[model samples]
Target: MNFHPSHPLQAFWNLAAAPIQAMALEQALEHRLFTLLAQPATAASVAQQLGLNAASTAVWLDLLWSMDLLVRHVPAGKAEPGYAASPLAARFFVDASPENCAQSWQYRARSLARFAMQWCTLLREGFEPDGRTKEGAAASTGSWAQAAREQIGQEQRVVTAPAVLHLMDALPPLPRQGRFLDLGGGPGHVAIALARRLPGWRGTVCDQSETAEVAQDNIRAAGLSDSLEAMGRDLSHEAIGGGCDLIWCSSVLHFLHDPQAALSKMFEALKPGGLLLLAHAELADDPVLAARVMPFYAGVMLRGNHLPQPGEVAGMMARAGFAGIHALGRIDFPMAPVWVHMGRRP
Candidate 1:
């Protein structure tokens, strides 16, 4: 038998050290280090430009390189090496890139980190209702509105829009000219993308008053004011307006007081033979897949929100009088993969 040396605690140690890596990335983002490193620059030059300590900056650059966020280059006869943003950093982290999601990423990271710190206490004593949800509908709406203005729009524009567009390709042909509702649409980027794809179609985005205002601004900026409108209403209490052809709702059901009733509301809102595309992260059987989803939504579940199990949403849709229901597999979202289900009202 061959003997091998191993450390049993390696995994735990890595888990313990995970925050160090996160902080390193956060600091780089905070200082706009990747923007500066977009082009190759020596540590000394970077330190001078950013007013960072010379020796410490060199060490930090090496750490970033080790993390694969930056690349290092050595020039002939040069004592110092040059560092530049790695391909991954250049594409997603650089400020100049249109696909930049650094701000949005940071927003989610900070929020999750705060929640993570409270996990032990929450598990022991349960969560206290906060302004995010425990308060009245007005306060919850306010929180979502803030997210819309701050990071939701960026996430939608850079991440959700593309994934939704790709998913739509798999659906059967949609009508050339029809009305659609973007349920819980933040900033209305998804609706704008659809409108651009289906030029003859008009669309509505419904959310809280403040979030709807954000969507309205985006609609006007996209030059879609003529065809798209934003409706401000409490979806839980108020009726989501009647819709004709299509409805695209994603990640909204988890927060609703009664997901089944909301599905029924959507059923009544749709025209006969209308399509409903519902996308949300569901608890998975596979541990790896579950890990992709659970951590991001652990706080939500702890706060008394429902994270659906696999095939759970489809059952609710069926109970609500939707027909031709089927799962459309999973699609990548900002932090996790969401299962998409399609149903039609008969």
Candidate 2:
């Protein structure tokens, strides 16, 4: 007997999905449990109301039961247990629940499902110049400003922008510090965070003119302008100036139609051995559960930017001719996971 040695390159293995499970779940979500949980109903009553044949309805119920999507409960003075939406579904699946993020995320999920269904055609037809986006779909529903107007938004901590790498705490202090450049910085959240950690560092937050105005106001509000500041630059087409030590590209790439090109430009702006920190939206640790949550953002990326994967990110940095690459911490704050990748110019 003989065994093969490992290949010197990445392996591309085919994934065989159990479509039966997915189909069962989809059917239950759409038909039986969708309205049945409006009030307690037996499987037979649900089937009758939804027009599902007894056999098919039984199969759907069984699948939900096995998956813990529904619980069988015995009503008082009743012999058989009546079926009801499981605890998980009651809180999350019910559309009327105020706790449901479905409205905020429904657009995302629908977009992904449409794309995944046509992925084969997409690969073959290639992408249009604007990008491979679905028509009529908009990115993130609205701009950050629109969100702020609706949700007391001003400039609050959604989360860290350019996440600090572990090396920040481990590496020896540097002899000279350059100006920090934060692209797509909102309300100076990143600059303030960085200033707190590095007193000697001066920073700039560059964004659209309107956003820049907001960010500048936020920087002054924090009294960090003694060290950090803000600027307005359209990074999509403009050449950003230099004299920067570390450039923070947080949550910007997912909105970039050409992330690699932007990364190259970022690399060009850095001095030798200067750092380029990047943060982008990522999937959760549980791949299956995240399948429902993360891919929705793909629509937002498709319509607006390209949310690159970790491997794609590393490859982009490499193509930018950066070195000393590092992986930093992740943000999985019950909403979505954001990946942090960084590198240094040689």
Q: Find the candidate with the highest TM-score and give its number.
A: 1
State the displacement of the C-alpha of residue 222, model 2, in Å, after optimal TM-score superposition.
1.3
lDDT of 1 by residue, 209-287 (tens): 8999999999999999999999997788999878569999999998887888899989999999999999999999999
Model 1, C-alpha of 275: deviation from truth (Å): 0.4
As a TM-score, model 2 comes out at 0.55
Q: Which run of 10 residues does model 1 get worst, by summed lDDT?
A: 128-137
lDDT of each: 0.90, 0.65
Residue 146's C-alpha lDDT in candidate 2? 45
Model 1 misplaced regions, further than 4 Å:
1-10, 130-140
The residue pairs found clashing in candidate 1 are none
lDDT of 2: 0.65
* Residues forming the 10-long window of minimal summed lDDT in candidate 2: 148-157
Candidate 2 at 139: error in angstroms?
13
